[model samples]
Target: MTSRSRHTAAALALLTLAVACSTGDGAPAAAPSGPPASGRAAKDVHVAFVGAAANLNFSQEMMEGAKYAGQELGADVQVVAPPGPDGQAEVGLFQQVVATAKDGVSVMTLNPELFTRPAADAIAKGVPVVAADVPLAKDSGVTTLVSNDNPAAGAMLADAVLTRLPAGKKGTIVLGVPTPGLPVLEARLKGMKERLLAKNPGLEVLGPFDSKQAPDDNYKAWSGLVRAHSGALAFLDAGDPAAFNLPKIKQETSASWLCAAFDLNDAGLAAIKSGQSVGVADPQHWLKGYVATRLLIERALGKREIPKGFWDSGAAMVTEDNVDEVIARQKGPEARAAWYKKLIDEQFADVQGRMKPLS
Candidate 1:
């Protein structure tokens, strides 16, 4: 979904490598000071996600994670974004972030080569940067990456479909994708198509439609496919855009179809709860933001050092049966606080604290 920001399209065009967020009240509120355990307080640590827009479930949740970590670590952090969905647009936004970012910058990269330079420049200049979603190029002299294993998660979605369909049933499947070149999205499509349709001559497959088009275009494309292929059994979507509209499309077109896609938001969870869709691959984007912010602040404050490598930001499966659990765990301050503690324990328990070339 796109937002109408005050940022001009012309200004959005000049973006190049990018980077972090602010308080809930839209003010620059630093963390409240307390006993300084490290004899150093973390202040002015900025964490940013590309394509940040109001009410965007993924980015918004990530910002909340960062804010939570900032409060815990006594870090003054803020989140920022650029007009996006366009990779190049993020590059311009990141460059601007680097120009004035504070003690540390936690960034999520999209366009690799374009992003590497600015992020690298920040790292070179003594501003610690942590990458999430899509990490900076491995050789960029930056360390720490937080994101789901895309292809593996894609494989898991495909597995969910096979498990859901009745045995000996061969049903037509439709694949939906938002855009090309995004490694995660592309990996999802690649993994699904290869596994779901392998040597199944009786199975029919539809277009990996260019879903990056406007919402109307996506609705048109998806509704048309669902109608023509009413017999289709599984709608395997590779991006959130497809999943966001699938329930509505099926509802309006009177097509009851099994579907799967990446990410989960309130509406998406509702779709699952209503049985309008089956499962979604949850990348735990909030964890990425929270962890990235925490790590950046610790490293910036000289309280800790991040091991240089991928952090394998894990994923989860959300089906109707267990969707309620995810819904509950992600709500309220108490639940999130508990979830963050478990995450830190599971992900950062043991490490050699050394840098190695990315695998």
Candidate 2:
């Protein structure tokens, strides 16, 4: 549809949706309509991601992107997260803001399924929602998902390990997994497992050994698995204890064992460069945040537009060969985001081509 048509549809939806004002009744209440009272992103314009406001998940980078966009747009953007990583909490926080928050929203998925209903609810309440990281249901009214093809990412991360394996050689590979039941991680593991086994029939994939979402628990889980699964050729992980914390734990236990995970932290990158671990998959965290804010702001103000499908944020693998290049890009927050944008334009040509320049 044309921009004018889309905007008209959005405006009608906004004014017509049931607005639960102070009375909590499903009636149109005196909610703030259209844009900030004064600027692009005034205090009234709140945007939230998945993790808590304080936790050091990828949301930190996302928040940074929000801040960057807010500053550029001359708006005061409020960044918040659910109290925990749980989807219910995320939806709860979303509902809380639905009544009070004006302007746009972006939510990274902990559980995309649960998000569909709440996302529809938010849309009904006239808030344009952007699904970042994990995608909402295909039918959900919310369009513009700024995320990766997670299972594809998993298969990609798996290739990092698969290539290094001696030709025609296959053995047991251990998986250090983050907490259970997250859709994104599950897809990652699925991709990793399918590819790893497909390449070498003799290869055995074992234990998405729970990382438990804590440094200590993750270390314990991985270490215990390693000790039990001796002769394991390589250890692989999409993230969590597998990504950020496993480096130190692996060093302490079995430095020679090949390991891989997705995403990165300072220590994880160092491990990759030093060759303690195989590699870390780059999820393009900065881009997810940047694109999310860009989408939310545009849709809120009736400017930018995207098709029904997800804007795959794309992924990359940082191995020993490219470790230095990745390190330079990650020197600081700005550097990290800048590097990703460069790659996004180069690698995700379709997204870049379609993304309307938010002037």
Candidate 3:
């Protein structure tokens, strides 16, 4: 098999393992004593979670959170994903889920525009839809979005990198995105560039290069970039691929340039702990999943209207000092939920007041 094929196979294998581990006995969790508009118990409410890609670590983490919320709230949560970042496949899956899901659907996609009609159709049919990770357009008929502030995350990453470099450093700092033209990724790159440039006018920012999404291709893209810019002061990425791949490339070449990115995978956490990366900006994928699912469940149970606009899921910078704690929290769904309990409770208590305009 070609290297890309091998990488795809490995990623699919990991995804399979994750799904297998997450699957439980077909029995539903006990429902709270309440009936929805359909006169069904809360446990009978079905919530569909549609993810952009099956192989991404952050996406898997989001699925875990979705399942955890399902178990906690006694909702039937079904998670699905395309094999890769195929926008058409994701849109098709969203439509299918909306058609069959009895209560609500939560979708995370790179191409929100493609989902506009499908989402509106679902909402028109009384199946509430909420956007997760990627915010949908206002005209999409999706009322709420659960996501971290991408621009803020980018600025946070830039600040982390700046802490390592001397004042007014003149060398280049390269930026990359696994999927070019993605708004969330672009927002991060924009935030990083603005912050880095604002802080150090002498520093030269390089391309927000097109780093491919798949693992092997991502490594090759970053590897070539690093080789081409051997004298770069630091390297930053807007996607999880670089969080895993850049450190490997850095070690292989014994490159001095600091490396960092957004999102957490095992490799990314290890890189931070081992000092291969300056730090990683975590967009809190698990929280996004949990909140989105929880919101749908609440709506299904008639607890409240699904709040409109953006619900900030929050973000954090993971460094060596906190990498162990972050690693511990990622041990399992229960651990993650427990770590986020206070934040979750606070946010859910006043979702309407807490929400911001999508702009």
Candidate 4:
């Protein structure tokens, strides 16, 4: 099969998986805007996945999802990212990509405010833009947003920590992220802080420290935070797996700090298994990329109507109690293959059945 044919085939497979895993009682999955067709769009639609280079795993999964969509739609998909930690470099890269006037572009929107003008210019040039993992309403040029239900996910994180904390009273919990001013990180912190405040009246959110999304930096930042806030009862890692691997710091600290992190990868899974972290809030990131590309493909191909608003692919809660079952539920590409499989097996079975005719 050609790349386009492969992606179309994968899209059929993915819809099957999404429907199967989403519903509890094996209900049929809902239909998406796009349907498989005989001919690809005349114009080759180009899709781009933009984000941080340092965090390769997440972006790579997002790219894979986009590529899957691109292959199905006969799109030319490109994954572009900033070379380093500098947000300014990312801004420049966005300008360069937007300047090209690609057919469709999906960005992570790490800092929406900075990219708003350039994003608007891209839209003016006829590039339909979608922001992922972060909302960009401030950028009127952005057509849609693909994200998780972050605050609810944040609340889920808080609940995990609260469940482990001392009974009947809230204690101080530190929130860790990659940075302070970045839009996505800020939203996550806002959601987490709100959830922590609402659930445990006695619970106080202490730090939104910059973990830098690096393992060593996670170790260092966490070490200092734990030392300064020795009374802290819990730690909420709002971003990556590195935050969960703080056992060394936890061991040295006088206070017993319970941990809760977002998402699960090998490291985060290991941390949960070791009993170091209590639970995780997974945003079903693969779905975010998969659906975003699906919507764009449908639009570019004139196959269906494109919605004006955004889509929240939603998040799934995984705790130490359920980690084994969750891990058992996956098959395929290690990056997103398992989630895609679970989707097919669970939520989208009805949609899966419908797709058979197209295949």
Candidate 5:
């Protein structure tokens, strides 16, 4: 099915589930008068999950987490995204959700500034908003931010690259950014360059060249860069498309440059297993989605006060040593949710304690 059709089907299914779990008056079914009830107080709550692009693997992984959270919490989670990274289109969707969402909305965007006003308005209208993946500004009026520490993840990627290079190696490394000027990507690139230079001043870091958001265009951009910089020591990317495409390019061209990027798309995993790329810096997208939705549900149910700051969703590095384990954990939505159950319980148990000021 087409991407739009898939999104429609998923939303409809979640809505149907929500209705089935509600009472005739459209209120959540009352908990049984016995021992403490399981955590399904959000039976009729409707939460919206908005993403920057529907076609990207990172976004799909996040949607999976959102859907799984709905299943676990008995909430209705509707997912939507633009076909590509169109910030304007994403802002429009966020505005619409803010006006209509019954419970709350969680949005992941490349352009957080575009969302500031709409998010503030949503908060004023009693609709909570959580910034997922890319964080909004400190005063964006979002209930909380669930995302990886992008700069730290970037430095981690640089450290991974450093392992592949010899000490005092004097060579070039190219950085590809699927969306230039994106706060998260720029922060990651900044951290990476700084780390790389600090560790190996002899290394020459090249452009965070614009690797377009569309898959086809992104591949083309990486392919052109590889061809133009045949002698570069390594290629690192701050986006998902490159994680999948760079390995393909490396294999097809029989290039010797080390390749690494962010995200754990299937192709990228395969590349790691086959030793085509060094590793991927995982932003834990699924966890971010689940945390955002769960927080919104808790707020709607009056179970908890959603924190108003940055909640570090965490990050990881997927390499040959742990690729199989990561693959097993990601076998399906249920498996992914189960794997994160402990972490979720801990974080939700002390939401405020886990949050740090949004910097």
Candidate 6:
């Protein structure tokens, strides 16, 4: 059918369905009107997503993609998020979600050691589990981790920073990371630092900043480093959100410096577009969320054992040249709808008929 015809049919069908439904008191109830209801109740698979609240946009994108997959598989995807960026609250939220004994769980391991035993216990009790953003180590109980190649991601950032510097200019470069021991962020930081230092012998590496990847804190730490070392040439921010605020630092400081950043959010995208930020790296989170959900639903449907391994979802760098394309692709509601469609097509290819979304 033509697009217009299809839309009209959908509208009429929704109107008819609305009239057929009754209220709790036997009066006509206001029916939800839009696309058809997602067949979430049909499939018994239950998936849980646990993530930090401060990274709402990032977490929401992953959940949105997963929910897209769940709709395609007619599975129910339950997302239990912590209150905010507080690590303690995140731990508490995980405990609550695991206690519910959902069929499947996909958690972002901000603190793997803290959650490993608890996650393992949930797995031991027969709940299939996976990790996202940060992966579980060999001893961790998660069945799989959907993440990017951190070292490679770091290398990309370093490459961008080095490319902009004068061929022979030598100065200290400060690398900012979320935490000292966070394997993922550290891997990237190490890769960037080592690669840059290897090529430039005269460069002095100031440090791996201990800032918790919070914007305000990062600004203070980064600004202090820049001020202390008037000779510093570049700044490496491991995440994009922090990278987005580099303009303020540049405006306030009288020194000229280069910056390499990662991830894409509204602020980060705008920063790149306006040339305030040098680069933002993406791990193709849209694909990660889509694939992770598919793996979970596959196990639930076929009684297959959950797959456990590290999958590098992949990464891409956005600079001044392609910032517009990146930002344009993520413009609004259509962007999400397109991502959901892609997830459904790529992950649920085998179960085309069963694939659907929950409203």
In candidate 2, stretches whose alpha carbon ends up further than 4 angstroms from where it belongs are 1-53, 82-89, 113-116, 138-140, 343-359
| Candidate 4 lDDT by residue in tens digits, 1-359 | 67644543343233211100111232222245345542544235555656644354455456556655555445556556653344555555555555442656677655667777777887888888777776665545665676766767877777777777666575678878865676655666788888777766777777788776656677788777777877877777777644455644664553467877776566666667777667778877767676676666556656554455546566877887888766664334443544475663443333223221100
Give the worst 10-residue stretch by lDDT in candidate 3. Answer: 14-23
The TM-score that candidate 5 achieves is: 0.87
The model with the greatest lDDT is: 3
lDDT of 5 at 29: 31
Higher-ranked by TM-score: 4 or 5: 5
- Stretches of candidate 3 off by over 4 Å are 1-39
lDDT tens per residue, model 2, 1-359? 77644543343233221211121221111113333323332333454443322354565666666555554443445556643354555555556555544566777755677777877877887777777776677566776777777788888888888788886686788886675767778888999999888878788889787766655667777777778886888888766446656677677765566788877677788888777888988887777876777555444444434335567667888898998998897788667656666654453344435543211
Local accuracy of candidate 6 as per-residue lDDT tens digits, 1-359: 77644543343233211001111231111122323433333255566666655354556566655655565555666555543355555565565556553667777756776776767777787887788877665555565777777888888887787788877677788877765688878888887888887778788887787645656776787777667766678777775446665656775675477776777788777767766667877766666676676566655555244445665557888898888877777875447556445544443333323322211
281 Cα displacement, candidate 4 (Å)? 1.4
Q: lDDT scores for all predictions?
A: 0.66, 0.65, 0.82, 0.61, 0.81, 0.63
* TM accuracy, model 1: 0.80
How well does candidate 4 score on lDDT at residue 132? Answer: 72
* Local accuracy of candidate 1 as per-residue lDDT tens digits, 1-359: 23433243344444322222232342222223322334443445544444343234555566666666766655566565453444565565655555555556666644566767777787788777777776667667667776677777887788787887766577688888765576767877887777666635456667676665334566677777777778889787776655567887777777767888877677788888888888788878778887777776665565556667777768878898898988897777458767667766656544333233456
Candidate with top TM-score is 3
Q: Between prediction 2 and prediction 3, which has the larger lDDT?
A: 3
- TM-score, one value per model: 0.80, 0.78, 0.89, 0.76, 0.87, 0.78
Lowest-scoring 10 consecutive residues by lDDT in candidate 6? 15-24
TM-score: which is higher, 1 or 6? 1
Quote the lDDT for 235 in model 3. 88
Give the clashing residue pairs of candidate 3, or none.
none
lDDT of 1: 0.66
Q: In every candidate, how many clashes are there? A: 12, 2, 0, 21, 0, 4
